[model samples]
Target: MALMITDDCINCDVCEPECPNEAISMGPEIYEIDPDKCTECVGHYEEPQCKQVCPVNCIPFNPAWRESKEQLMDKYLRLQADAK
Candidate 1:
């Protein structure tokens, strides 16, 4: 599943640099996560880096964009391929 930044985000500018996929960015108010680029760190890490470093715990799985582990991995592979 893709992760999302909630309104509780303090915009401390911490999560953006942590994303391997470059999925997180500054939104109109708070930080936002791009679902298309979000792989939940499947190809990069055992855990979501942004969530790990988020101070306010605002990052959460987007229930609306639910995805299976296999799907996430596929996305990760595709992203990796695209980079090359």
Candidate 2:
């Protein structure tokens, strides 16, 4: 699943840079995750880097954007291909 930044986010500015897919960005009030670009770091790291660096633990799996590991990998591959 893609991760989401909750309202509980402190806006510490740590999570955005950690996202390997460049999915996280500043919203009107806080950080937001783009479900289209998010891969949960499946192809880049063992864990979601945004969640790892988040201080408030506001980053959580978005049930609305649920995806399997294989699906996440496919997204990662597509992202990599698009980068070229």
Number of the top lDDT candidate:
1
Please give, for residues 1-84, the per-residue lDDT of candidate 1 as tens digits: 899999999999989998999999899998999999999999889999999999989999999999999999999999999999
The residue-by-residue lDDT of candidate 2 on 1-84, one tens digit each, is: 998989999899999889989999999999899999999999999999999998889988999998999999999999999999
RMSD to the hidden true structure, all candidates: 0.6, 0.5
Q: Candidate 1, after superposition: displacement of residue 10 in Å?
A: 0.5
Which sections of candidate 2 miss by over 4 Å? none
Which pairs of residues have clashing backbones in candidate 2? Answer: none
- Native-referenced Cα lDDT, model 1: 0.95
lDDT of 2 at 56: 84
Q: Judged by TM-score, which candidate is best? A: 2
Taken over the whole model, the C-alpha lDDT of each candidate is: 0.95, 0.94
Q: Candidate 1 — which residues are off by over 4 angstroms? A: none
